[model samples]
Target chain A: MASTEQEVLEGLAEIVNEETGIDTAEVELDKSFTDDLDIDSLSMMTIVVNAEERFGVRIPDDEVKNLKTVRDAVTFIQSAQS
Target chain B: MTSSSDTRIVVTGLGATTPIGGTVPETWEALLAGRSGARTLEFDWVAEYSLPVHFAAQIATPPEQVLAKVETRRLDPSSQYALVAAREAWADAGSPDIAPERIAVVVGSGIGGVHTLLNQWDTLREKGPRRVYPLAVPMLMPNGPAAAISLELSARAGAHTPVSACASGAEAMGYAVQLIRSGRADIVVAGGTEAAMHPMPIAGFAAMQALSTRNDDPAAASRPYDTDRDGFVLGEGAAIIVLESEAHAQARGARIYAELAGVGMSADAHHITAPEPEGSGAARAMLEAIETAGAALSDIAHINAHATSTPVGDVAEANAVRRAFGELAGSIPVSATKSMTGHLLGAAGSLEAIFTILSLHHRVAPATINVDNLDPEVGLDVVRGEHRALPEGPIVALNNSFGFGGHNVALAFRSV
Candidate 1:
C-alpha cells in the first residue's frame, strides 16, 4: 500500500542536519551516520520515529539496532511494509 | 569484583518537579501530607483525542515559567524537566566545586519526547518537510535528558542513558552508585524524566487496557492494591538526586540525607509487557539489593513499591515482597504512592526513590490514597489514610521498580 524504499529514503533525507543546515544527500546514504553524515544516535532515533509514523508500523528495537546502513533501512522498511 | 567496603555512596542533594510539587521541598512537603496530585482533565484537546483515561499527574507548573523562553523552545518537555530537576539538585549539593572530569550524569527515561516526535510528525505531514523544526531530532531522542544534564554540568566522566521502561530511573541511580563505588566518578547527577502525556501514548496504553477508564472520578482512578482497582493513571515530570562518594561529601561538608546502600537489577526474560506471574525475578532483585546493601532484612522499615494499580502488576509485586522479606515483609509498611501521584512510568522509580529518602529524613511514611478496600491477595501492611512514623535510629528503605520487558530494579537507602 505504500512506496517503501523511496519514501523511507526521502523521509530520512528530510531529517535536518544540525550543523550543516541542509538535508542528508543521496551521496551520503552509504556513509556512516556518525562519521560522515554527522548523524548521531539521537538523529537515528528521530529517523526511526518518523519512519514508524509514516508507515504506521512498529519497528522492533532489535531490528532497529541492526539497521546500520541506508540500504539496510530500506530493506527493513520494505519488509515491514509487506 | 569490587568489595562492599570499596564503594560508599551518599545522597548529597535532591531535586524534583512532580505532580505534587515543583521543587524538592515543595514535593516532599506535599508527599508527607498525603496530598493527591491527581485531578480531572480540563484541556479541550482531551475531547478531540477522545482518550479513555481522563486524569493524569501533570506537573503542577510548566517548566517554561521557570526557564528562559529561548531555552524552553529548543528543548523537549522531557529535557526541560530534566534540566530543571538537575539545576536544583546541582545547587542543592552546595554546587560542589569538583573538577568537571570527576562529575557524571545518568538521567534516563522510558519514553522520551513522545510528544515532540508525534507533533513533529504531524508538522512534516501537514506543513511539509521544509516547515519541520531543526531541533526535532535533539528534542525527541531518548537520551536527550541525560545528554542535556551532562552538558549542563560539563560532566566529562560519561553520560549514560538506560531505557529499561519504568525501571529506567532506578537503573540510572543504580548505575550512578556503581560509578562512585568504582571510582569512575566522584559525583553523579542521576535520575529520570518523562513528559509522555501525549494522546498517542495514552491511547496506546488504553488499547492495552493498562490505564484506568474511570472518567467519572479522575481523583480516584489510580487505586492501587484495592479490590476495586482497575488500572494506573498516567503521570509526567522528573526527579533527580546528586549522589557523591562518602569521602567527597564529607570533604565538601555536604548535607547528606541518606546513604545509597545498594542496588540490584534482574530480568524476567519471560514476557515483553506482562510481569512474571510468580514475581520470582522481582523477589530476586529485592533480595540481591538487601545483600548488596550489607544490611539485614530486619533493618528495612519501609518499602516504596512499584504497584501501578494494574490488576496483575500489584499482586505480583506484593507476592515478590512477601517472598523477599518472608514473614517480616507483612510487618514492614509499604507505600504505593502511585495511588496518589499516578504512574510516572520512567520517572516513577526516581521520584519514588526521592520519596523513600524523604521517608528516612522525616521519619514518616506517606499514605497511599484512594484505597477504599484492600485486595485480599495483597496482604502487605500498606500504609493508608495518615502518615505512619518510621522506626527511629538508623533504618533502611527499599524502592522497587518493575518495568516492561520484565526489568526489575531495587534500590536500598539507609538513614544517614
Candidate 2:
C-alpha cells in the first residue's frame, strides 16, 4: 500500500487512468474527479472501490461524498490505511 | 421532414459480421459454398455450468480484431458488433455525402448485453456491488448498439432500437423504411446485432427445447426445412445496411444494390415463445409487404425464409408462404439461411436481408446446406445441394422474420 500522499496520488492516478480513459498525467491532485476527470457518480464510486482494493482500505459510502478531488481521495486513502 | 411516399428508397450498401464470415462478400461466398458456422463453444463456463446444446455460431471476426483495445473495453459486444458492421456499411455506401442532421440509425437486438449483465451480476455477488463496472447500465442497454452507431455518425434524425425478440432486426428495418418513407431522414443505418453467447441464455433456450442438442455433429444441427432437423442452433453477429432515398443515391452516384420497396409488420398475439402454429399472422405480413410494395405476387422471384431450423417453426413458415402467395409460392425458391448461419436471433433478419439483396444483385440463390431429407410438410421450394442462378430480368425478393412474441415482419426488395 502507498504510505505517503504523493505515492497514494500516483496510485490513484494510475487506477483512475485505467478505469476511466483519462490520461495518467492529467490526474493531478487538485483535479476534480467529476469536472476535470469527467467521471460520473457511478465511475467515481468505481474509482473509490478500486482505490480501496488497491490500498487495502475500506471507504464507506458516506465518506465517498467528500472524495470530490484527487487530493481528497488520496488523503482519505492515506488516513484510512494509517 | 414531410412524408416521403411516391418516392423510392434504395439500399446502397450492405455490411455484416456473421458466423459464416465477417463481411457481406465473405458471408455470401460462404453461404454459396454451403458452409455451416456452427461448432461447439469453447467457453469454460459451458462444462462448469453444464449448459445443454453446447454449440453456437460465434462471430468469425470478433470486434476486438477491428476496434482498438480501449474501444472494445468500453462497449458491450452487441454494440461492438453493430459498430463493426455499421462502419463497413457506411464505407461501402461511399460514405454518402449527407448532412448529419438528415441521418438516422435503427439497430435492434433480441437481448442486449446479456454477457455484461450476467458477468457484472456475478462480480456484484462475489466481490460486492461496488466491484461491478460503472458503465454496466449503458453497456447492458438494448439500445446501446443503435446509440453507438448514431454517435459514430452523428446521426441527428434519431437513434432507435426495437426489441421484438427474434423479429427485432427485421422490425428495425421496417422502422427504418418508415423513417425514410416518412421523410424523417434521407439516410438510415439500420440492422440488428446479438452477442448473448453466455451460458445462461443457452441453458434457458435449452430448457425450453428451442435449441438442438446434437452435440455430436454441431454443423448439421441447424437443418431448417429438413427432416433431420431437431431445433435451432444459437448464433451471434451483426448486419447493417445503408439505405438512402433513390434521389439521394442517384444524386451521389451511389451503387444501388436493391430497392427497399416496402415492409409489412404484424403480430400473432398468441404465444409468448412458440410461434403461431398456423402462421396466419406471418402470412398476412408477407401479403401486406407485397401489397405495400405495389408488386404483384407473381413479381416475387426469391424469398429468404426465417427457417430457424425448429421443426414446428419450419412448417409454420412454409404454410405462411403458401397462404401468403397461394400456389405461386411453391415456385419461389426459398433460401433457408439458418441452415448455414444458424439462428442469429435479432441479427438474423438483416443478415438474411443482406443475403436477399446480394441474391437479387448477383442473380444467384445460395444453397441451404445439410438438408439430406426435405420435410414433406414444407411445401415451398427449399434450395439445397447447390446454388442456383436467377432469371435475367428485374427481380423482387422477400425476407420473413418472426419472433417469440409472435411478432412478424416481411420486407420486400427489388433489384436495381
Candidate 3:
C-alpha cells in the first residue's frame, strides 16, 4: 500500500526526532538533515536504517547519500514503499 | 627533557560509580561502614543461560538515571559509567581553568564493551548485517571511555587507554602521573571502567573457576583473606580521578585530596593467570613504588591490597607485601577492600586508590569485611571488624592492583 506524502513526512519526522532528539515540528520537508537537524553521519545512518524498517522499504546504501533533506528521505521512502 | 620526578602530581578530585555507591563520598562511606555490594543477578538471562556464577557487584545506580536519554542510547554501559564518574570528578575539581590542549584523559578497561559487542553480534545474527548500529564500533572499542571523556572535556593533550586486565585502571592513573610530570599535560582525567556483566564473561570465569560460586550468600561471596574464599566476585563499574600538577592545583586553589607520590609497575612473565607463587614481580613493584616516592618502608602507613578473595591470589598478595616490606609489613594496616566492593577488575585499582586517598585525608583506614577466618598463609596485619585510625603526621599509603597476564601496579599516595 502506498502512503500519502504527508503521512510519509510525519513518519520520517518521528524517526528523525527519535534518532537526533530534534523536535518533530522542526523536521520540516524543506530542512536538510545535516545542516538543519544537526544530525551527524552516524545519526543520519541510524535514522535511515530505522526509516527503512518503519516505511517497509529498502533504502539502499547509495540512496542514503541522496537523502540530504527531510523531503528527500520522505519522498524516497514513499516511492520505495509503493 | 625535564626529569618527570621533578614535577610532583597531586590528586585534585575523585569520582566513582561502583557496586557499593554511585559517587566517591557514598562509596567511601559504605567502605568505612563495611557494606558489601555483591548481589544475585536479577536479569532474566541468568536463568535463560544458567550461568554458574549468578552474582556480581553490580553498580549501585543505573546510568540511565544519571545520563540523558540520547547520551545513554549512544554510549555503551562502560562509556556511560565513565562519563558519569568523570563528570563528578571534573565538577569536584571545580572545573579547572586549564586550556583544552593542556588536559588529557586516560581510561582503562579489562574488557571493552562486552555488552555492546555481544548485543551487536546478536543484532547482526538476528536482524542481518544492515541492522547493526552505525555507532557500534566506537561504542565497543576499549578506548571508548577515554575518547568519550576527552570529547566531553575537550581535552587535547592525549586520550590513551591502557589495557592491562585488572590493572588497567591503576595503569591509567600511573600513566596520567607520567603525563603530567613529563610536561605532556598539567591535568589528566584518568581511571578505569568496566561493564562486562553479561553471561558470557560470567560463564567464562565460571569455567575457569575464577569466580566465587556463593550465589546463596552473595554478600559474603567476596571474602578476601578468609580461609574459605574460593575465588573473586566479578564486578562492574567505573572510578575516575582528576590528577593535576601540584603547581597547577595550587594555582587554581583546588582542594587537594592527596599527592600521587609514586607509581610502580612490573610484569611477572611467569604465568598467564596464576600469580608468581613467590610474588617476586609483585614485591618488586611494591618496593619500586616506595623507592620512587623517596620514602622508606616504615613510612608506609596503610595498604589497600589487591586481595580479590581468590584463594591463591590473596595468599600471593600477602607474600608480595611481606617480601616488599619485610618486618614492617606486619606493622602496616592492610585493608582488602575488594571484600566489600567485589573486585571491580579494571576499576578496582582506581576505586581502591580513591579509598586510599580518602583514608589518608580522613586519617582512618576502612576495615576489610568478610574475613571470618584469615588464611594461615596470609601474615599481614589485615584490618577487620572495625575501621582503624591513623597516627597524625606525614604518612604514605599504597594501593596495589594485579591483573591477569602478570601485570602488577603499586601506587603510593601521601597525606598532604
Candidate 4:
C-alpha cells in the first residue's frame, strides 16, 4: 500500500510509536529500533506484524531479524513490493 | 531476629490481594468481620459457555485498576497479581537492602495466563496471525508471574516457579524455606497467584464437576463442613510472604510476622482428582509439618483447614486431621477459610499461610462464614459465627493445602 520508501518508513513510525510509546515525529531512517529508539524485542514483534499487515508484505521471523533500523524496514518493504 | 540455631527461618513480611480486600490489613479486617467475597459474574462468557457455576469470588480490587495502563497491557492478569502482592511484601519488609544476588523469587500458579492464551488464540483464529500479540507466549506461560516479579526486583540469585496444582503457592513458600536453609539466598519473595476467572477454566471445571451450582445464594454457597455443602467457589487473587533467616531479619531489624517454622509435603499416590478418601496423604503432610517444626501435637493451638466445601474433601480432610493429631484433633479449632474467601486455587495455600501467620499475631481465630448445620460426620471443632480470641502464650498453627494430582502440603507457623 505504501507507494514509496519514505511512505513505508512514515507508516512504520506510527505503528512503532503506538506499540512502544516512542514518538513517531522523532523516528528516522538512521535510528535503530533497539539502540537509538530503545524499543524492546516484544515491541519489535508488534512492529513486524503491523508492517506485514499495512504494507501487504510477508516479513517472516528470519527477515524480521535483518530489519534493524527504520531504513532497513522501509527498504525491505519497498524492494519486496517492486 | 538474631538466629541462635541453624534452621531458624522467620517471616519478615506479608501481603495479599484477596477476595475480601486489596491489602493485608483490609483482608484481615474483612476476615475478622466474617464477610463473604463471592458474587455473580459480570462477564458475558459465563452465559456463553453455559457454565453451571455462574458466580465466583473475584478480587475486591483488581490489579488492572491499580497498575499502570501499559503494565496491565503488557502483563497478564496472573503476572499483574504477582507484581502487586510481591511489591507490597517487599515494601512491607522495609524494602530490605540485600544484595541482588542474595535474593530470590518463587511464585506459583495452578493455571497461568489462561485468559491471555484463550483470548490470543481467539484473535488469531478470527483475525489472522497479524492480530496475535507478539508477547503472547511469555504472557501465557505458567512461570510468567514469577519471571515478572524476579525482573521487577532484580532477583538474580534464582527465580523459580513451582507448579503443583492448587498446592503451587504453598509449595513456593516451602521452596523458599529450603532456599534459606540451604544457604541459597537470604531473603526470598515467595507466594502464589491465580487469575483464572475466564470461561475456558470455568467450563473445564464445570465439565469435571468441580464447581458448586449454587447460582441463587452465592455468599452461602461455600458451606464447608455443612451437611449440604456442594463444591468450591472458584476464586482469583494472590498472596505473598517474605522469608528470611532470623539472623538476616535481626541484622536489619525487620519486624517479624511469625516463624515459617516448617513445611510438610506428601502425595496420595492414589487418585489424581479425588483426594485419598482415608486422607492418608493429607494426614502425613500434617504430621510431617509438626515433626519438621519439632513441635508436638499439643503445640498446635489452631488449624486453617483446606476445606474447599466439596462434600468429599471436607470429610476427608477432617479424617486426615483426626489421624494426624489423634484425640487432640477434636480440641484444635479448625477454621475453614474458604467459606469466606472462597477457593483461590493456587493462591489458597499462601493466602491461608498469611491468615495462619496473622491468626498467631492477632491472638484470635477468624470464623468460618456459613456452617448453618454442621455435618455430624465432621469430627473437628469448627470455628463458627464469631472470631474467637486465641489463648495467651506461644502457640503454633497449621495451614493445610491439598491440590489435585494428590499433592498435599502443610505449613506450620509459630508465634514469635
Candidate 5:
C-alpha cells in the first residue's frame, strides 16, 4: 500500500525520533537532519534503513546524499512510491 | 626518568560491574561474605551448540539497567561495561577538578567486543552485507572501551589499551602509574573490561579444556587450589580505578583509598598458552613489584592471587609465589578471590587490585572460598574458611595477575 504524503511525513518523523531521540514535534518537514535535528551520518543511515523497512521503500545509497531535509526525504519517498 | 617512588600515586576511587556485584561496594561485601558468583548458563545457544561448559560468572546487573537506551544501542557491551564502571569511579572520586588534558583513560580487554563482531558476522552472512550496522567496526574494536571512556570524560591526555590477555587490566594500571609518574597525566582512569561471554568463546575455551565442565554444580567448579579443581570458570565484567598523582589528589583534598606504590611486569617466553611451570617469570614480576614499592618482605601482609583454579595454572602460580618470596611467601595471607568471582579475564587484575586495595583500607582480607581440600603442593598461606583481619599500622598488599601469551603483572598497594 502506498503511503500518502502526510502519512509518509508522520512515519519518517517516528523513525527519526526512535533513532535520534529527537522529539516527534521537532521533526518538521523544513528541518535539516544535520543542522536542525543534529543527526549524524551514522544515525541518518540507521534512520534510513529503519524507514525503508517501515515504509517498504528502498532508499538507495546514491539518493541518500540528496535527502537534505525532512521535506526532501518525504518528497523522495512519495515520488518513489508513486 | 624519574623513579616511580618520586611521584606518589594513589587510588582515589574504584568501580566494577562483576558477577558478584554491580558496584565496588557490593563486590567487596560479597567477597567478604564468601559468596560464589557462578551459575548455570541460561541462554538457549548453550544447548543448541552443546557447549561442554554450561555456566559462567555473568554480570550481576545488566548494562541496560544502568545506561540509557541510546548509549546502549551505539556502544558495544565491552564499552558499556567500561562506561558504567568509569562513571562510578569518576563520581566516587568526587568528579575530580582536573583539566581534560591532564586526565587519560586506559582500559584493556583480553577479547574485546566479541559479541558484536560475531553477531554482525552472522547478520552479514544471513541478511547480506547491506544489513550490517555501520558502527560495527567501532563497536568491535579492542580499544573501544578505552575510547568510550576517553570520549565520555573528554580526556585529551591519551587513551591507551594494553592487550595482554588476562593481565591486560593490571598492565593498564601499571601504565597508569607511568603516565602520572612521568608527568604526562595528573589523573588516569585505568582498568580493563571484557564481554566475551558469547557462545563462541565458551565453545573455544571448552575446546581447549580451559573451562570447568561441572555443569551440575557451577559455583563449586572454580575451586582454586582445591585438590578436585578442574579448570577456570569463564566470567565477564569490567573494573575501573581512578588513579591520580598524590600531589593533585592532595591539592583537591580528595579521599585516598590506598597508595599504588609500584607496578611490575614481565613476560614468560616459554609458551603461548601455558605458563612457565617453574614460574621464574612470574616470580621476577613479584620481586620487581616489591622492590619498586621499596617494601621489605616483612611489610607485605596480603596477596590477591591470580589463581584461576585451572589445575596447571593454580599450581604454577603457587610455585611462582613461593619462588618470589621464599620462606616469607608461606606467611603472607593469600586470597584467591577467583574461587568466588571466577576468572574475569582482562578485568581480573583490576577487580583483584580493587580487592587488594580494599583489603588494605578495611584491614581485612576477603576469604578464598571453595577450597574444601587445599592442594598440598600449594604451600602459600591461602586464606580460607573466614576472612582475616590485618595487623594495624603500615602495610603493603600485592595483587598478582598473569595472562596468556606469557604476560605477568604484579602491583603493590601500600596502606595510607
Candidate 6:
C-alpha cells in the first residue's frame, strides 16, 4: 500500500520542475493549472506521464480526462498502488 | 431561384501532438524536413510479449514533461494527447469569445484508452477489483478525447466521436464542417488522438500481419507505394483544428488557413478489413467531394493521400485517385505522407488535412519520403524526395481517409 496522504505529497514534491527551480508543493491540489499554477497542456501531459512512471501504473484515458484537481490524481494513484 | 453563396468554412487554427512533434508547427516542420519518428520500444513489456514489430512513432515530447504529477495520474495518455493538442488549437484561434452553446467539439480515435484498459486489467488480476480506480470507464470510453475537449471549451452544441478506424480523425473534421454549415455551431474544435503503442495492440497488429516487420530500418519501414512495402508502422499522437464559419471568422479577424470547401463520405460495405478491390467506394467519395465543392476535377492541384503503406491499401487508394481524377489524373500530384509519419490510425485524416491546407497556403507540397522505388501500378503523380511547388493562384487540395470498416471520407479545401 502507498503511504499516507501527506507522505505521498512529500514524495511527489521531489518530482521537481524542469522549467522553474521549485517543488510540486507549488501546485495546490484544488487550483486549476490554467488558473493557479500556469501549467499548460504540454506541462499537464508531462505531469501525467511522470505520475504513471512514479506510481508504476497506467492511468486510463477516460480517468485522465476528468483529472482537473490534485485530489483526483492522488486518489487515483492511491488506488493504483493498492 | 438563385442559390445563395455557400458559406465558406476555414481552418482558423491547427494543433497537433504527433509522434514527430508536440505542436502543429513542430510537427509540420519535422514533416517537411523528412524526420522519422519511428523507433524501438523502450518499455520492458516488448521483451515479455515477444512482439515481432517493435518500433512505433511515439510522441517526440512526452506529456510527463508538461502535466502536473497528481493530475497526470488520473487520465489516460490518449486523453492527455487530445487535451494537449486542443489547448494549442484553442489558443491559436485567439481563444474566441463565443458562447459555450455556440461551440462544438468532435475528436475521434480508433482505439481509446487501450493502455488504460490493459493496465487496469493487470491491476485487477495482480491486486483486486477494489484496487481499480473508479475512472476506468471514462478513460476507456472512445469518446474520452472529445468529451475532454468539450469540457475544456465549455462546448454545448455537441461533442461527438467517430470511431471509423484509421479514418476517424478525418471524419471528425468533416463532422465539424457540417456542424458549422448546418447552423449548429459557429465554431468547432475537431480532430483525433490515439495512444495505442501498447503491447496488446502491437502484438495484435503483428499477429494480423498488419504492421511492417522491417525492424532493422525503423525509419524506412513505413514505405508507402514502394515495391517492397509490407505494412504500416503503428504511431501515437493527436491533431486538432479549429473550424469556424466564414462570417464569424471575418468578424473576429481570424487568420484563415484555407476554406474547407466540401466533404464526401461513403461506405464500401465490401469487407471489414479490406477495401473494395477496384476502390469504388473511395472513388465515389472523392467524386462526391468534388461535386459538393462545385469544383472541376482539373481544379484540384494536389491530394493528401491516406496511404497507410499497406500493400493492398496503397493500391486501392491509388486506383481510387486515378478513377476520380480521370483525364487529369496524370497531372495532379499526390502526396503519401504516411511515408514519414507512419500510421496515426484515427488521427491520420485530420493531420493529413492540415498538411493539405499547409500545402495550399505555402504553395509547397511536402514530398513523400522513402519511396525509392514507386510501384508501377500507381498511375498518378506521386511526389517524392523533394517538396513540389504548386501553381500560383486559388488552388484546391483533397484529403482522403479510409478506415477498416470500409468507411471512406474525402474533404476538399481551397485557398482563401
Best by DockQ: 3
Better of 4 and 6 by lDDT: 4
> What residue pairs clash in candidate 5, if any at all?
none
Residue lDDT tens for model 4, B1-416: 22233568899988899999999899999988889999999888787867788899999998867887567878899999989999889999999998898899999999999989999999999998778998999999989999998999999889999899899999998999888888888999999999999888888887888888899999999999999898899989999999999889988999998998878999999988999998999999999999889899999999999999999999999999999988898999999999989999989999999999999998888999889999998999999988878898889999999999999999999999
Candidate 1 lDDT for residue B274: 92
TM-score of predicted chain A against the true chain A, for each candidate: 0.73, 0.92, 0.94, 0.92, 0.95, 0.73
| lDDT string, candidate 2, B1-416, tens digits | 44467678899988899999998889988888888999999989889988877899989998888987656877899999999999999999999778898999999999998988998999989988778887888999999999999999999999999998899999988888888888899899999999989888999899999999999999989999889888999999999999888888888899999999878999999988777887899999999999888899999999999999988999999988988888797899989888889889999889999999999999988898888999999988888888878887878899999999899999999888
Worst 10 residues of 4 chain B by lDDT: B1-10
C-alpha root-mean-square deviation, candidate 4: 2.8
Model 3, position A15: C-alpha lDDT score: 82
Candidate of highest lDDT: 5
TM-score: the better of candidates 1 and 5: 5
lDDT by residue for model 6 over B156-225, one digit each (tens)? 9999998999899999988887788788889999999889988889888888789999998999998899
User: TM-score: which is higher, 2 or 4?
Assistant: 2
Q: Is candidate 2 or candidate 6 better by DockQ?
A: 2
If you assessed candidate 5 against the hidden native complex, which CAPRI class would it receive?
medium
Total backbone clashes of model 3? 0
lDDT of candidate 5 over B1-416, digit per residue (tens) = 12254798999999999999999999888888888999998999999998889999999999999998778888899999999999999999999877899999999999999989999999999988877888999999999999999999999999999999999999999999988888889999999999988999989888999999999999899999999999999889999999998888888999999999978899999999999999999999998999999998789999999999999999999999999888898999999999988899999999999999999999998888889999999998999998899988999999999999999999999999
lDDT of 6 at B136: 75
Q: Candidate 6: which stretches are off by over 4 Å?
A: A1-82, B1-5
lDDT of 1 by residue, B1-416 (tens): 22144568999898989888899899887776767788877887688988777777788879978987646766899999999999999999999998998999999899988888999999999977744766888889999999998888999899999899999999999999878777788999999999997778888999999989888887788889999898888988999999988888888799999999989899999899999988899999999999999999999999999999999999999999998888997999999998877888899999999999999998988899888999999989999988899989999999999999999999999998
lDDT of all the models against the reference? 0.86, 0.89, 0.91, 0.90, 0.92, 0.85
